[model samples]
Target chain A: SQQGEEDPQALSIQEGENATMNCSYKTSINNLQWYRQNSGRGLVHLILIRSNEREKHSGRLRVTLDTSKKSSSLLITASRAADTASYFCATDETGGAQKLVFGQGTRLTINP
Target chain B: NAGVTQTPKFRVLKTGQSMTLLCAQDMNHEYMYWYRQDPGMGLRLIHYSVGEGTTAKGEVPDGYNVSRLKKQNFLLGLESAAPSQTSVYFCASRRPGTGRFYNEQFFGPGTRLTVL
Candidate 1:
């Protein structure tokens, strides 16, 4: 079974707007990571938040993790048309050579 | 520095034909993984390697076989191709670290395989 499940399988917004995506997991994970994938390309690492950390920021990207709820959310402020891609959340149950289970992903479209 | 790379950007195979997919990393990462991406299934791990000459089965490993003979290269092999195995294959590598933290993995461009 997949460890992570992302809500709002698809989303659309205008450029410069904000986009929020949620991810829920079924198990206790050591850490969770977010990735972005453009069509016909490999995934690019966005940010990673550990279970001990509540929130993290990287430029326009913000990530929040609630270990108690086994869930995480990624927020993109001032979204750009280039940000249009499929966003995925992956959770690692343990550390050191751990396997990452990814969610079905949320397809976000940023219209210019 | 060519973080991760997979050979044969695209391939088409006939049923019962066998082929091998190669993944190489230049970052000296100890953990290597192979995954297949399908529409609704996301990315499912086929096999993974913790270190050289070590391989382990993952969530969906029934039809896939993997080997990591060298420290920097991981190979995924299909003895007999099946139509069901058609999907985009991705290879990733992560450097080892301690504590309860997630390590960012570098991914290759991916290989699109079609079995007819």
Candidate 2:
């Protein structure tokens, strides 16, 4: 079963606009990581936010985690056509077994 | 360096047929995993190996089997193909990070399997 669920199953936006996606998980996590998948390709690691931390940034991507709510959000500023892809959030449970549970994912499209 | 690679990018199998998908990693990661992706289902774990010669079931282990005979290779096998087993399969490997935490996993290109 998927431990996380993403909101806005799909999103479409024009270039230069900001895009935001949210993910909610059921159990405590050691860390939450975001990944991106291009059409018909494997996923690429984007960014990882540790449980102890609340927010993280990399380039045009920003991620905020709220453990109290068991949810996280990914923000992409100034979206571009190339930024269009499926985004997924994976959680590593807070226990001995280090396995990642993934969410359904949000498909984002950036129109040029 | 070809972080991770999967064999047979695409395949079609008849119901009741069997096949094995191969996955390899060159990062010398100690952890390897197999996952299946279906439309609207993101991805679900099939099995995982923490080290060579050791394997464990994941969230979705039924209808699938896995083997990790080598540290850098993981294989997933379907004994009896079914229409419901048709999906995109992904293989990933990861190494432990500082403390007991783990680093991000590297995924293969994925293999598309179809059963009719």
Candidate 3:
């Protein structure tokens, strides 16, 4: 079974607006990482937040994690047309095969 | 530096045909993994390697086999291709136990395979 499940399978917003995506997992994880994939391309790492950390920031990207709920959220401020892509959340489960399980992803469209 | 690279960017195969996908990394990561991406299915792990000569099955490993003969490369092989096996394949490599940041994997561009 997939360990991570992302909410809001698809979303669309104005270029200057903010976008939020949520991810929920079933098991305890060491960390949760966010990635972006433009159409027909490989995934690009965005930001990662560990279980021990509550929040992290990278430029316009903010990530928050709540272990009690086993969930995480990624927020993008001032979204741009170039931000149009599929966003995914991945979890590194505890004591597993050193692999990360990815969510189905949220397709975000930033209209210019 | 080329973080990670996968060979044969695009391929088309007939049922029962055999082929191999190669993933190479220059960062000397000890842990390597192979995954397949299908529409609405996200990315599902096929196989992974913790180190050279070590291979392990993942969630969807039924039609695939993997080998890591060297620390820099991980190979995913399909002895007999099937139509159901067509998907975009990705390879990732990671270094474990890094302080402050962990489980940060480098991914290859991916291989688009179609089995007719």
Q: Which candidate is the best by DockQ?
A: 1
Cα error, candidate 3, residue B86 (Å)? 0.6
Q: After superposition, how far is residue A5 of candidate 2 from its true place, in Å?
A: 0.9
Q: Provide the TM-score of the second chain in candidate 1.
A: 0.96
Which segments of candidate 1 are over 4 A away from where they belong? A95-97
- Give residue A87's error in model 3 in angstroms: 0.6
Model 1 lDDT tens row, A37-57: 999999999999988899999
**B59 Cα displacement, candidate 3 (Å):** 1.0
What ranges in model 2 sit over 4 Å off?
B98-100
Model with the higher TM-score, candidate 1 or 3:
1
CA lDDT scores, all candidates in order: 0.92, 0.94, 0.92
TM-score of chain A of 2: 0.98
lDDT of 3 by residue, A1-112 (tens): 7888998999999999999999999998888999999998889899889889999999999999999999999999999999999999999888765778999999999999
Q: Using lDDT, rank the candidates from best to worst.
A: 2, 1, 3
Give each model a TM-score: 0.97, 0.97, 0.97
Please list all clashing residue pairs in model 2, or write none if there are none: none
Best by lDDT: 2
Docking class of 1: medium
Q: Which stretches of candidate 3 lie over 4 Å from their true place?
A: B98-101
Model 2 root mean square deviation, Cα atoms: 1.2
